[model samples]
Target: MKDLLNRRRLWVGGKGGVGKTSIAAALAVLAARRGKRVLVASTDPAHSLGDVFASELDDTPRRLLPGLDAMEIDPEREVEAHLSRVTAQMRRYAAPAMMDELERQMRLSRQSPGTQEAALLERLSRLMVDDDLPYDLVLFDTAPTGHTLRLLSLPEAMAAWTDGLLAHSRKSERLGKVLAHLTPGSRRDLASPFEEEGGDANHDPRTRDIAETLLARRRLFHQARRRIQDPEHNGFLFVLTPERLPILETARAVSSLEDAAIPVAATLVNRVLPEEADGAFLASRRAQEQSYLSRIDETFAHLPRPRVPWLPTDIQGVDALERLASCLEQAGL
Candidate 1:
């Protein structure tokens, strides 16, 4: 098979309780079988990748199927790592006790939703830059509507924040140096602790560099968002069940993505009733499905539509998932 996956990332998201994860996993499996290295990642805090794959996955990618790997990230872990880096930078000139107290306070501040998401994005950027485990395709199994929107909008939000932060950082660095040189006790008071600890206190160039890198990371968010909207590279798939509420939710999601100018490549209507009209129960279910499927067509006329019929057995193991993949492929996904 030839390579079919694009280097651009795929973002799978939709209303809460939608089978977004299942569809994302199927897409990754299909792409992998098509001879592309793929990573299907669960970016949602309440992740279910392990459950879907019937195996545990760490922050690092673990091979699940042929040519496909999976990773489940907990933003809390990323937040803790970010906090450590921040404290290390501050400890260059701060006293040990003072640094500890500052770190404690900063940890409290990171409890905010915005800070947690930023930390996760920073970690994700690092993974993207890593050369060792580069994959042809990346699928992000995102959180529900509200959280997913915040994650998607991080690019614009972080861009604006980065501009202001860069300016402020530069101004503060200059002010700090001037204050240290001009004021008698200012240099000694701040520099003494680091000097005693054998730490370089010449305003610590590393800290400045890290601040610049963090600002650059904010730019990476914008780049990632652009990659998502780029038709040749990224594919955004919104998954929904065949029901009135999920159908309505999918419509809202498509509108939101369009409003943000994010390109949506496809939609997956998951767990639909099989197209069999034999029994009364089955026939009634199929009728209901046809009704919503028509509704889906009207809403998602721009992209390809994929459907997953309800199977007798649960989709858990690789064998079952492969069956699911076959069904998706047959649907022209």
Candidate 2:
């Protein structure tokens, strides 16, 4: 278990409303208790880390407990930020009318399906790879199965996009230098955000270098794509309630993860009724749970299946979160 713990990037996912956030939070707290620096991030667009921690989290990472830090990545914010940086360079190159249309197009691009989520994952990979923010373990509270599957496969789309963008940038650099003479501002070439502003917006050395570097970052995305595809470094933890629909959805998600070559580390069955019973009401509930429990065992016979009992209340406060973590220990996950 220690060996598995040391070499895994655990990603908790499943159907929506199946307690993936709860399981991810518990696991994050458990790793922290074991004396590892852990970061629990929310990639779900709905953003529940704040609700789970009983505190607000912005784009910046915040310390949640003694050893655990948490953050909720708002996909829209990431996409807007990325577009703003890139468009500043684009404006320096294109004509006034063309720049206006491009800006409009970029805004529409944000509204495009999957763009925000993909950008969020790319940003998460960057944080994980940064030496300065090194962590012993990183837990991702992923979106529901459909969205999460798309996010996991985002690397392929991003790689393709990078290839096309790089080609466009090369052409833009040449055209931008030529167009600088046609503009009212007598500039040598369009400068990048990194370049100092001269009378000619095109003449900024920082802008030119930024354009070159942005194109080069294609290599970084490629490296991230390769890393995400590796099983040893990435683990998918499927969370579900012991119910029919959730169970079926989990099966579909597991199949998709396998298709994408992402590893399934374990299965977490949450809000399970305890096996013990006293009266008719309690006994019938346990019996129903037992039926589904049997199905889960049969379904995931090859993998470790950990069960977490239903708490009397929502696992919101730190004490409740810790109690949930204790259940993980009891199940020997």
Worst 10-residue lDDT window for candidate 1 reads: 191-200
Go through the candidates in order and give each one's C-alpha lDDT.
0.76, 0.77
Per-residue CA lDDT of model 2 for 142-218, tens digit only, reads 88889877776766776777668656755675566556656787654353332233434334464456546555555
In candidate 1, position 194 carries an lDDT of 42
Model 2 lDDT, full chain set = 0.77
Q: Estimate each model's TM-score.
A: 0.84, 0.82
Q: How does candidate 1 fare on TM-score?
A: 0.84
| Best-matching candidate per lDDT | 2
Q: What C-alpha lDDT, on a 0 to 100 scale, does residue 42 get in candidate 2?
A: 89
Q: Top TM-score: which candidate number?
A: 1
Error of 2 at 163 (Å): 3.6
Number of clashes recorded per candidate: 0, 7
| Model 1 misplacement above 4 A | 1-7, 128-132, 169-211
